[model samples]
Target: MHRLQPLANGLRTDHPVPGIPFVDDSHIPIDDPAAIEAVICREGGASMGRWERMNEAQGAWLAYTADPLRPELAWAVRHHPEHGRTVLLLLTKDAPLWHSSWRGPKLLFRQGGYWWDGTTWYRPDQAWDATCKHFSLRPVPDATTITAADILDENARTDGGRLLDVYRFDPEAKPPDSWNEHLAMWASQRAADARPLSQCVVRLSAPELPADQLIGVPKMPNIGDIVAPTLRTYIARIQRELPAGDG
Candidate 1:
């Protein structure tokens, strides 16, 4: 959102929610939630959400935000208390948007995620070619009402079968499973007459969306490299924006 200046450009925040105006650059401590830290939750701007360790004995830390201004979606992050990479999740309460896309798509977890274009629901891997720089993804859904519980839901899934999507160029394959499978199945049907794999376009299935009713994820504008100076500016903005707490 232009309301927030450089933050609207992803050049200003460490975590930028792609479609929404929210961005979080808060420096939450990994070792202890109670430790002195900088938390930025501006009323009209960026928010990191209320955070705490998900489990005791130094387990995963979580940050969750349920923006009242935008009720259709929620944002969360899960990372080990120490030495763990953060995983960002964008959760939605929009049934029409979620149901229109292919279900059971996996991201870093089993049985989660969705992929969609303007018209069709495509699996993640087969959704793009080697040429894709940015692709569409919906990480979690099925929340009737989003709250702190949504972040808890993300950590509850099995960490197995991490299938975002698969590539299938095989010609003699069985019936189609996904976009990749559909392509191969089409090629196998043609046998010798089929065009080269590079030239083929998937017919796309479960066509359930014009997606006009879905939440608008504003396309990200490239703000160039996030160097030290920009980051310092980011932190300063957070400090400058959020109202200081009572001592």
Candidate 2:
């Protein structure tokens, strides 16, 4: 139906669904209730629903528009009260986009906020007037609709497992004792391989002497004479070894 689905169980279809002009000014209804129902039925029997959260005084409106940049793309919308201004939600109605191959009727809670009007593609304003005009709209019903803030909070709560999968975190890892410890552990896991202080050790080896020659021990250099003595000793050792080979 070009008309909206009856409001039931927290969802009301968008009425006077936005229609887009095609090849010869003939428009295709963008939010066809039957097509929406077919999609819902195909995808595990989910509902394409809207829930009103604010009255007309709060300046929220649920809208729909075909994307100008990608004609195949369509959007469901809800205006939100942010601070003293208004914001728009490119809504997904009943399920997240990820659920139905990124085509579910997910409602816009607070994330996935992209602004649009039928004529223009992407915008960032609350822009109720511009949007309504662009889509040939009337006053949408006064009811609670989904907002970006609601979805954002839901995403934060529900995305923990998905994030863990993205970074390949060990699911069985124990909770860190403190926040600092947690940070340190995370850094250690991600940083490059380094030979640790505990693994480093110094080894000393004596110079090999021929069995026939008497071993002449050189005096150790004091800290003050370390550089000079070290150079002298190296030179003397090389000279001595050369002469012995000549013999």
Candidate 3:
């Protein structure tokens, strides 16, 4: 039984999407670009690296985290004067994920995962805007392709902190089952209509497991439901993003 706990200033906590934490948010500052940049940068802290600004329009600036996770992953913030708050948008490289129609839990391929539109948490396919008919995809600028770092992340592990025996290599060094189950519970969909974030193993940054572990990447499924298009578009975008054999 998971739920999104609301914060004081009309904001809420992010779902513990696998591999990520129950990360908090900072308020949208003054309308200046520098202000927005400073907030995102400060919030990201040491866990995240430099961010690459992709595009800005409609008072929203889209920037991708230079961290090795992927190029398609980025955060967009738009200031709505009426609301007096800027909307923090977590968008994939494709169309605003809500428009992608892939309404499932977060996956390694379709990482739109889940988003909170200041009021409601929306699945990839759950969002609809009467005002804007076609939500066009953002243009990805030419930049160096980002990937996970070769060295282990300073704070990558979600597994309860346990010192390992350096003498031997054990890939499946098990953590307490309750620990896994506890995070597993939070990882799923929180709302009554939303289901748990099951189906895929924690992949990026070794979400559920330790970095020393060796688990293969989740396969990009070729078929999905009508409202849920397959990861073909996801992979296609990645291919477009990377040079010839880079992806």
Best by TM-score: 3
Question: What TM-score fits each model?
Answer: 0.22, 0.17, 0.24
lDDT score of residue 40 within candidate 2: 25
Q: Candidates sorted by TM-score, descending order?
A: 3, 1, 2
* Poorest lDDT segment (10 consecutive residues) of candidate 2: 1-10
Winning model by lDDT = 1
Give one digit per residue, the lDDT tens place, for model 3 in 1-247.
0111100110121222222222223333323545434433334364222222222223433222211232233333333222122222232333233222212221112133223232223232334455786332222222121122222243444444222221221212221233333343333323453322332222223233233543211211212221112223433445322111000
Worst 10 residues of 1 by lDDT: 1-10
Higher-lDDT candidate of 1 and 3 = 1
- Structure candidate 3, residue pairs in collision: 19-207, 68-147, 68-148, 188-197
Residue 175, model 1: Cα distance from true site in angstroms: 22
Steric overlap count per candidate: 1, 23, 4
Query: Model 3, stretches more than 4 Å misplaced?
Result: 1-15, 20-62, 65-114, 123-132, 135-247
Instruction: List candidate 1 segments past 4 Å from native.
Output: 1-48, 66-74, 91-108, 112-247
Residue 8's C-alpha lDDT in candidate 1? 19
Error of 3 at 245 (Å): 24
* Local accuracy by lDDT, each model: 0.27, 0.23, 0.26
**In terms of TM-score, how similar is model 1 to the real structure?**
0.22
Candidate 2: lDDT of 85? 16
Candidate 3 local accuracy as lDDT? Answer: 0.26
lDDT of 1 at 99: 23
